[model samples]
Target: MARKSLFITAIVAVMVLGFAVSAYAIGPVYITWNAGGANAGTGGPHQDYRLTTEKCAVCHSVHAAAVSNAAAGEFGPDPIGAAETQLLLRSSVADACTYCHITTNVSGLQIYNGVASNYTTDDQYGHNGSTSAECADCHAVHGADTFKGFIAGKILKAQGNLVSNVSGGVQTEAAATLNTLVSGGTVFTAPAASDGDYQVTAFCTRCHKTFSDASETTITAGGYFEEWDGSVTFGSRSYKNHPLKAAEATFVASGANYSGRVAWADAYTCRSCHAAGNNRVSTSYGGPGGLVSWSFPHWTNGNAQFLVSGWGVSDANIGLGTSGANTGKPSGSHTVMDGAEDGVCLRCHTNGSSGPPNNATAGVNVTF
Candidate 1:
């Protein structure tokens, strides 16, 4: 009798546990299918391609392409100029990009470089008012596969000159040649310096010729080498920059905050310091009228050199005392950072208050 009672209790407990498990089970997520509509399939802002022909309709109109600037949408206000070459919604390549890439657009990434949604040609902060390259110049709308010398993949359309091959410390350029942006949508991070080609870095150097390792010899320019071993002298002091791709152990002595400050162990990368998001707005650092006003596209501020976040030093704040640099005001002419602290540099180098002494010391003054 006792054994039977114990068995019955065990069976009841198992049944209750099983019911709980079944109730909390999660189902698989399904991608929405396209049914002959613009951007109808599994396409979101950045993922606006590859699913169906309807996606192309989002930018192109077969016969009913209007001439007036209609309101914004997946099929927004039509282009203002004459009919585009390939049924594009906008007459110019940059106009079509600005149409959807605005903040008020119904869908797509908002990479507008102006205060308002419309195109602001006088934008002085980032890469907005350029007469040179347009949006289509850098990225492939239809996805570049075979048009270029090499496909960097992920929709990056190579426009300018870039280092195509890097072998045995030798670099080669593919000038005006085609190449694609490397990596896919899901995972984007700074490739290690040991990554032979430094594909992502090479992609950026396509236009920003000064930032490539290939230009290190002739050019004392700002590139991978400049960040790793170069020094930028400001006023009376010379500052050493953080290494772009160095061993993780180099920062082992930095302290517990080191890991938290940098997401990757291989130090900083182009993407590590630069990215697009709401936090990178102009007002966050300073308003448009303020000394540190910023614009998007290349993520640069007035005088901040396009740092993702930090105190931007304008001509007004260049040679100010600690009170000036700390308060964002200009006063007497003083050397840079006369004991003044900056949030940008301090993100990695602590203020020597907590654990280890700050590593940003150079003889006397703190050099970022």
Candidate 2:
């Protein structure tokens, strides 16, 4: 009887684990964009494209694409003059992800540096790597599972023939080194199409944190290179990540805590809160004024608060977020999230300026 009971228990444990792993995440989890059999505007945010947690699985792994993987996502940029620059992405070597995520707020944000006149009709980004050179040619999302996510480092094609001849095929070598991000000299080499042995997370911290390597590899004026964590070992992203994770947030219901409370016309999507939500609004001079709707000061006085261990810095400079971190004041005075331990004050506000460390920092300093 004892042996039978033990066997039954073991089987039950396996079933439970499978359920956790296989069940669809109902909340702000990931939703992959699969073009396999999908049609445009068929499934996505606002009915733009069909969305499924499965599709997001293409680039990001299963439950793994949580707040912890901010680096895996694109670093949103706000190009000057362009409304997109106000808090949207301009452009990058990497393809824009908004194609399927489809929210007009980001889409409406001007990218291409006002070159809209050239491709005025539609967005210039997200062609699905179909051109002569595509996002995959120079970049990748689900890199060798070991490589973590996206092009965290530079890929050097040494083996495969750079130029493939029609008849006589030339096998070229493909290798990936850590690049300037982390491995100053370390090269994560890939022997074949599937061998991503030379990958490292440290390399990702470089651009993510807006700084160069400790050895000062590939420093540039355009990218945030100098602005890094104090320690070389911590790297740039690590620094930013720390402050962000350490930040706090309150998960208020807006009177509509979970169910029918939140508004449908008001604007909410899997991308909003599921993307760990943008913290910049909760932790900076400008509080949570989301693009979902025209609602300025979106956050509300939180009813629940939680302190995190990591420094909070979302993709782009967007910092930690509280679900309803509205600002009667700036993002500094977090009311319910962690009860005033809100670290967003560091973005702006300082001594004699406005909110502060207790609301302190070097980056943004508010005048009012």
Candidate 3:
């Protein structure tokens, strides 16, 4: 009887364990550092704590949660009537991301360099506006359905009349004209036959619509959308604006300079050169602006005026010259390309030199 009782107890324990596992499998998966697991090892955020159980509570609370005031200071007296949205611990989405991403000294994912106090200065670029510094504006904490890196959404709608079209000497279209431009839809997926270019160009145009249409008079300078639409001629030269939508196979075969420079199998996106570390210069280029330190395309070394160093100009005269110099490069009141690593251009252009030759005639011999 004793043996039978022990056997029955073990059987009941196994049944309970099985039910618990089954329940966990069918439960909704929440967004956490490691998907609500323990430590996330190398590529994940290096935090001592884990989201073992309560994932949602990590960022949100039901009642009486800690409130932070950015104006008064990060940690100051809580106001009598101050309240956070969705019961978040911090006052805003930007604050919440900065609370951990900036404050902590985690190893794998320390983004303290990317956070900016405000976007009022001229040097401060990228998503500059009332909610410019908000991380939630570009990324979704819950994850994204259309994009890989938690990108919020495509097809950003302008709130009000922001741009006016120009006719020869007069304004043609009014700010009320709502222009809808298409962006590179999804990134890193298998290339399609028709529109397989990387989506970064389109993604950026969603916000800066004035640059997407050449006919729009809102912007006086040449429009990037028209320049890189794969139809514009490169001066009188046969080469077109560095092919953004061309297949990797065709790009590699085009020339030896492109060999082994980028992942040829993948589609070329705007991030190829605009991304952090791609410039081969100090990750933190602009002092307080600190543009290049931000993740992916959000932050960039204004030194290159959003152009990734070593590559040819994205727009006209936007990248480093063959001589690896920014001395005379024109980029809207900012002198980009400090000539730190001008050889980065040789990655694609079959020019002159890559290393210390550092002369304007070093690589590809282009006089941009």
Off by over 4 Å in 2: 1-98, 103-139, 143-318, 323-368
Say what the RMSD of model 2 is: 24.1
Of models 1 and 3, which has the larger TM-score? 1
lDDT of 3 at 33: 40
- Candidate 1 whole-model C-alpha lDDT, 0 to 1: 0.34
Q: Summarize candidate 1's per-residue lDDT along 189-245 as a digit string, tens digits.
A: 223322313444445544443332221234322222223323332222122333344
TM-score of 2: 0.22
Q: Which tens-of-lDDT digit does each residue in 1-368 have in candidate 2?
A: 99999999999999999898778544333344333334322322222223442444333333332231234243322221212221122223232443322222332222112232212222112112332223333233332222322222323222222212111111111012123222333323323321222221222222223222222233222212223232223222222211111121222323533331111111011111112222222111122322321011111223111111111222212223333332222233232243233343332222222332233232223222
Q: What's the distance in Å from true for residue 368, model 1?
A: 12
lDDT of 2: 0.26
- TM-score per candidate, in order? 0.44, 0.22, 0.42
Tell me the tens digit of each residue's lDDT in model 3 across 94-195: 355554444432212333244544232234233332434345554445433233221112212221212233211111121111111123333322133222
> In candidate 2, what residue range of length 10 has the lowest lDDT sum?
261-270
Please identify model 3 stretches exceeding 4 Å from their true place. 1-53, 68-86, 105-108, 112-133, 149-205, 208-267, 273-294, 301-304, 311-350, 355-368
Task: Name model 1 segments beyond 4 Å from true.
Answer: 1-52, 68-91, 113-119, 122-124, 146-154, 158-200, 211-243, 247-267, 271-303, 308-368
Task: Score residue 261 of candidate 1 by CA lDDT.
Answer: 28
> Candidate 3: what lDDT?
0.34
